[model samples]
Target: MTGTRTVVRHAPGKLFVAGEYAVVEPGTPAIVTAVGRTVTVTVRAADEPGVVIASDLVAQAMRWRWRGDRLEVCPGQDGPRVRRAAAHVVSAVETVARLLAEHGLPAPQLHVSVSSDLHEAGTKFGLGSSGAVTVAAVAAVAAHHGLELSLESRFRLALLATARIDPNGSGGDLAASTWGGWVAYRAPDRAFVLDLALRRGVGEALRAPWPGLAVRPLPPPRGLRLEVGWTGRPASTTSLVAGLHRRTWRGSASHQDFIKTSTDFVNAATDALETGDDGALLHQIRRAREELARLDAEERLGIFTPELTALCAAAEAVGGAAKPSGAGGGDCGIALLDAAAGHDIAHVRQRWAATGVQPLSVGPTPERNQE
Candidate 1:
């Protein structure tokens, strides 16, 4: 029999829309979208012993034996999270093994490698890295084990794995990582991946292409330009998110009100996006910052760190609005400026640098998916 290998790579980080910290609460809802970084999994046949797995970011290597009833993982020197993540992989394999055994089939001895382009893998940016990685890794495991699972099924399975690791996570991260592009979201609920038709024409738009498709035939627009800055202070997202959830569970009415306000801010931002109106987009971003400040006042919102607060104020001084984009409490802040007017992009860059913050440009658009 000829052995063929499959490699799956999923791109982009994501943002939480409605739920935020509340999604971790019992029955709270949230929405997220894959932005533009990636995790990739490659699978091929191995003549070696058992099943082998490796990851660059986690710096882990593991071996597992796949017996009919269970999958056992022999941990390498990776950290606690990596070791814990390994168990999730084994669980997925066991699930696959169970399915295959029912079909009177044998699971393959496979070798897999997982890698990611995470700027701050250890920090909590609230970009849903763990969820995305879980989804991508499990998809690889499913492929190597010869399991028949649909994309939706695979996404849900990944969410289950991530939830085991981080109970407060809404699973929106996994869904967004599985499906890219602009999204309309509600927490704990599924997000809608938008397929926008451009005013100029459908052929010329430049959003992330849907999976299993090719780039469009037409040329994309001039591109999306923004200044991305890092706050340089690392925060533990696990603890922060858990604490936020606990606050919500205690019926901290103030906290809930702040979340509601943030939701309104995002809803306004969504309208701006649909209209493709730059002025309105900036207006909504400003509104989001104001609402986030109210949330920050609660001390549980986790929006402001000294560096992040400085960065936000600085960006606004330059005619842009800035706020915590990801899980907050300090990872990074995004500054949306008027690219057309050349609105003090350099000033914002200098201000960020003064605080030892790094300026990463979210420059230009890439090609979109086509028929």
Candidate 2:
């Protein structure tokens, strides 16, 4: 943070390499990677004593003012769910304002500009757009207020902001966005922190111990060539996760089995990545796909759509392993192949085209540690 008139920050989108569904639970480990697509937020002093947000993605400008640590949008604005994109931004601003207040820095009137390439023609690419926006917004606002922040502090603020909207979320995507590389992530108790922020303010929440929160940088695969594919159909991660919460399968014996299987696969995959064992890594990737497939069939969660099934099948037919990335009724899927199989990678994309799946021209960011 500086006396510079404006502050701009960019955060990249993410893809879950393994442990998608299970990662929702606190303390569950997941492997995630930052992608090239990003959301950018720019903040500058405004002429008036209020906040104004203009987003090119939504193609609209909205005005707001902070009322007692809460963001109150233009009086008549209405949205039924807290999962809206606008809500994520609003929450991020409010959380950062709270942090600034703790340091005796006054929140300022600013105009925030957002530009995103995480979507197409108003449809999100499902590349963790929400998480990227929140991280970028948090950085921009904190810097605009001239508050210095650590990478972990910035991540905590973003998580607090996100949990206000979706308490059940794991914030794995947020971790990848902030860290900017392959990461091994574990989520803290979002519900606990949200309540703490509500009662004690965000400053206290940031300093308080978050028991299950852990993030570690992991090495990128040594021999696997990562490829991403989109199904063109968007999926609602919040609704799908909320739906899972309502099902009987959550606390059943099957639930324990899923957790164990996912844990084993994730641990093994992590080891393979660390050791650069391509054979062992491929086995774990396929194991993860099978576990997700089993969960879909048994719980009727609709984790895999026809297009997703075809996407995975096409990759396997070309001697690779693939699976749906996130909530996965539609979104995107990832494939991993031996880096030497250049021709097979092209063939997989061709087969994906034959089945209506679009190959995404995105790759993982280079290895990075906490900023």
Give all candidates' CA lDDT scores. 0.57, 0.86
Q: Let me know the TM-score candidate 1 reaches against the reference structure.
A: 0.75
Error of 2 at 291 (Å): 0.7
Q: TM-score for each prediction?
A: 0.75, 0.95
| Superposed Cα deviation of residue 195, candidate 2 (Å) | 2.8
Candidate 2 local Cα displacement, residue 43, angstroms: 0.7
lDDT per residue for candidate 1 within 141-203, as digits (tens), equals: 666555555555565556445554555555666666665554544333222111221132212
Clashing pairs in 1: 12-36, 12-37, 29-187, 29-188, 30-186, 30-187, 30-188, 126-327, 209-369, 214-370
lDDT of the structure predicted as candidate 2: 0.86
Residue 246, candidate 1: Cα error in Å is 2.2
Off by over 4 Å in 2: 1-4, 75-83, 368-371
Scored by lDDT, the top model is 2
